[model samples]
Target: MTLTQDQRSLLTAIAQPWIDTSEWPLWANVQHQFDMRGQDADAIFHSLPRVGNEVSFASGYGYAAPMRAPIDPGHMVRLTVAGVSKLPRMRIAVGEPFMHTLRHMIDLYTRRPILVDEVPKTILRSGELTAALPKLDPWFVKVLPDLLSYEPAINTGGGAHLSDGSWEREVTRSVMQFRGMHTVEEYIEKTCEIVTKNAAQTAPFTIEEEQPMPTEPERAPYVDLALLDDLQKAAANTHWKVHKLIALCQGLNDAYKAGNPYVCAAMIRAVMDHIPPVFGHKDFKVVANQHTFMTQRTDKIHALKLVDFKDISDDGMHRQIGSSVPVLTMDNIPQPIRLNAMLQELLTILRKEAAIAP
Candidate 1:
């Protein structure tokens, strides 16, 4: 009953009669529903099958070239039961699960699976349930003098298969006719029952397969992960505004491993220019000369001045000359450990500044 816009869109599209198997209209419907660009939908629709226990796609039919998860809308595509279970998580008009209220209720009230008797109390307190009730059990004109006009799950006879593979044997709403449909209480209980499994499981490959398994080649980190992680955490907290200092430090490390000495030097100089504000200095040279933090770290300070690295960065950036042996190499850059220590100290000062603020 409760569904996200995407979930609603999914349900609405599928609930329509199977007579319209036209591919472009269905795909166009998907595009209009999601409100994304055409270029992105090409990749996004193809990828939905990759989402576990949610959206799925049909496979190619012919014998010549078999494929999995083909998005040809003419072929039937169905929702998995985990997708149905998530209906309770959606709040009527709101697209997000605020607290997953039913799950929270279950977690609080029962150590075991909820009984049909326990459902009424659980349903009344649920904000999503209340909002969804009116839409689901909407007042309708009498079709005849005796029969009541009613529709459950928006009148879709479409079935959602359980990700656990139990739907094949289970007597669920999917198999039930309109006359034998579940009551609201039974519906709630069964919704909880059918969706109790973890959805992360995937099918294992067998020896019968002909193609080699796809393997992604792993590359070692281009930077010290520890330093990168620390900077990334800091950057995450301060992301309301741009953080060029963090970006430069990350680029510096990446350039170091990639063996681009000119880039390393430029990044080093950029960090020196950019990071002085943390130390309350106008420039790195001034920070080196005046700031207590820089003065205290004797080795890093000495390395900055003695190596003439900043000037080399400027000359390479400004001068145009023949590249006989090139202007810079890894030897010209400051020691990685030394640079890391300096960045660590900058983070230390920034944290202290943040802590002391009112």
Candidate 2:
């Protein structure tokens, strides 16, 4: 029966505290005491009758093993996360998720099973010459070998270790749909959170191929395209939010040059909220306060200045237009210490994490 993760955990806790519900065997796992493994052997399996429009045909078997699962990582498979598709071939194994792939491999080895043929003898038809004559070793009335009922292994955990278990490891997970990673900022921000709680949690990530990305501008109107620019030089790279960050910076620059102060202000605030995860934090506030690269208390203060600037951008975004407040102008959005300390932090991180082109 299908159970919610919590329900499965509760049942296991009460019925068998030693069991780890999350590691429960799948239907095709051949390591059970009886057949059907962790589920049940005596369970009734059914098949529907088919005969064109009539129910004259009933093609079914008594018992059989379930179809094998496609869990082999040697097979190349691509998965789309937040619109971009990536071949989930664990590129950087830097965290807890990396350990998970290793454990899965060990489990596969520990529970390795064997495959045996279900041999069947030729069938002797009713009142045939062989049946009418002397009897053979046993009853020979049987269908083809394929029609014989399959038997589960007799010994408990009915699988045996293979002699050679040294295949090249292909790291990948069966799950991890990249849920809640809708936006570029969310991708960066959430990746940090997940990696912190989990680790480079991109075990089966990084790009196999990607559409071409734009070159870094000869010069940006305001701040340089920090993390996103370094990322552009890297080969075979893909980040869900790379384009979005570029677009936001472009928008902010265009708004500033065009004297569109409101759009400039909004984009500034958005960029601040978006880019902090590069230095590894959920928001600019934490990044300003805690970035390890910017160790100088004074340089750290400059990072805080970027965070402080976000307040004005916030005002330009959320504050209502009223006569009591003066309208925004180009002078109002003056660059903060030539993009301040955060850019240094960004460059260091992007260089370390991404393989920049020489």
- The number of the candidate with the highest TM-score is 1
- Going through the candidates in the order shown, the clash numbers are 0, 1
Candidate 2, residues 1-358, lDDT tens digits: the string is 1334433322222222112221123323321333433443223211211111111111111112222233222211111111111111211111122223223333433444444775322221223323333332112211111111111110011111111211121112211223333333343234334323322221224478453444322223565422333433331142423445555665676666466788877887777788776766788888777776545777677767767777677777777867798677767774645353455556556656655534
Give the per-residue lDDT digits (tens) of candidate 1, residues 169-279.
111222222222233334334433332222222223478956556643222223343444345344434422224554565566567756788887888888777777766
Q: In model 1, which runs have C-alpha deviations exceeding 4 angstroms?
A: 1-223, 232-242, 294-303, 323-326
TM-score of each: 0.36, 0.35
Pull out the clashing pairs in model 1: none
